[model samples]
Target: MRQPRKSTVEIRTSFRGREAIVSGAAAALFRREKEGGFFGISVKLHARVRLKVIVVNSVEYRPDVDCYIRVPDPSNATAVAQGFAPRRCHVDDFS
Candidate 1:
């Protein structure tokens, strides 16, 4: 039998000057709209060492590593604010 296909999105994020890939359903949350609208999702990292993260939309994010963050969607703030919560991400979480 064929294996079920996983629905995932790819997001290019950087940390500490190094580029990394974040892939999965969560990544889809960071996808930018087609009309060149507001920046994609907002991520805030909390780590001992300061790091810089570059998202797919060319927006720069500098949050602590291993910090829980709520993905911000400007288009639908109320929905995202109500539905999502701050989530933690580890270094290994990025590919």
Candidate 2:
């Protein structure tokens, strides 16, 4: 397993207060803390001037696949609250 080097991400995710383990990104040698379905990373972009990029929304992960996926609105608390939890699947439900 690869640990994050000087690079890391930590977000306070709360699904009844728990953690989102990013074993998938771990392959990419990146580790992060997931909370409210968001992970924060600290990086340095050296430039004569300054550069700023922004993430204005939430992030979600799929532990079943060990990766992050895009969602319409990650701010859905009831859904995002499933961090590090077993997914509730229905045989009739397919998305």
Candidate 3:
């Protein structure tokens, strides 16, 4: 007999100091898989600049894992416009 797949929950949160909320699956929050990768949320801040936010699960071999939000710095709009990498923001697990 084969084991059943685990059920996933929806996670929603707003970017650092942003009004928009990004939502994704609980299992593959910020992981990229070969079979079914989690899709990231995209938001446009300026006329020529857009940002993508994803929740990355960085726990290895652990029962309780922590998640983080990867997004561009809202304060550094000019740097983001100049094509810089997004920073990782820590997420608090209240459950």
Candidate 4:
């Protein structure tokens, strides 16, 4: 899949009735929306991309998507190992 252009850019956003569905990383705080049509959120972010990450032991091979996920801690260690954000290792790293 073709990855969307990844670039952080500042944007002023106005959410319509309910069409504020956006994807990608945001590095800003979104203020609360007003009653009528108002500026819902303004932030600095990257271009939206289709991201689907597989937290396997494999690092060299990632699915055709973007995911820099970090699972919340204090859950279960087993869940962490087999869950999100697995270590990215080389061939020699494994037996």
Candidate 5:
């Protein structure tokens, strides 16, 4: 069998409620178009990259600033792991 080709997209997201960074590699984020030229991209983050996490709520230290982070989807992860980033590693196993 052949591994499916992967696509990478950078997504700055807030996880667990705190200002954190998570790099994810995704397989597919299907898109659909609607009337009036409206579209949506559904992204399911990859699970290979190690991430720093935090948890917060509307009561405890609510964040007002938008955070920025890198995404390492299979393709991006493969790229980064293959010395694509400034400093890179080999993505042998994202397990």
Candidate 6:
């Protein structure tokens, strides 16, 4: 069992518009604590990143296999966004 960390994350799918609204990535971890407290690690996903992954299904699908879909990447992209200026804006005007 790994210790869970507190962090906020938002995962979105690229295939269509599906999304997993999680309070924190740590909530996804499943573990037991020796002192009776649960422990896990959380993942902080970026707001602009997307990712495509296979997710396992239960009851209707096989446990060994799973389905996949495009989702938001778990990395920060604010810097990238800041670097790009609006299409209407003139690059030379800033200077």
Candidate with maximal lDDT: 1
lDDT of 4 by residue, 6-25 (tens): 65655354433555435433
List, residue by residue over 18-61, the lDDT tens digit for candidate 6.
Answer: 66435465334321221223222222322222222345422322
Q: lDDT-based ranking, best first?
A: 1, 3, 2, 4, 5, 6
Tens digits of lDDT, candidate 2, 19-67: 6444676533422232334443332222122223353433332222122
Give the clash count for each candidate: 6, 3, 0, 1, 5, 15
Question: lDDT per residue, candidate 1, 1-95, as tens digits?
Answer: 12234555455765343553478764554353312333344455442322334433333344444444444344665654566464556553231
Q: What is the lDDT of residue 46 in candidate 6?
A: 21
| lDDT of the structure predicted as candidate 1 | 0.44
For model 2, where is the 10-residue window of minimal lDDT?
Answer: 43-52
lDDT of 6: 0.30
lDDT of 3 by residue, 4-85 (tens): 3364545465544334334566434434421222234543221121222354433332123333323433345553465535
The model with the greater lDDT, 2 or 3, is 3
Off by over 4 Å in 1: 1-31, 34-81, 91-95
Misplaced by over 4 Å in model 2 are 1-32, 49-95
Candidate 2 clash pair list? 12-35, 13-35, 13-36
RMSD in Å for all candidates: 19.3, 20.4, 19.5, 17.8, 19.3, 22.5
| Residues 3-47 of candidate 5: C-alpha lDDT, one tens digit per residue | 223645554654343543333332122111212122232333333
Cα-based lDDT at residue 47, candidate 1: 28
Candidate achieving higher TM-score, 3 or 6: 3
Name the better of 3 and 4 by TM-score.
3
Q: What is the TM-score of each candidate against the true structure?
A: 0.21, 0.19, 0.21, 0.16, 0.18, 0.15
CA lDDT of 80 in candidate 5?
A: 45
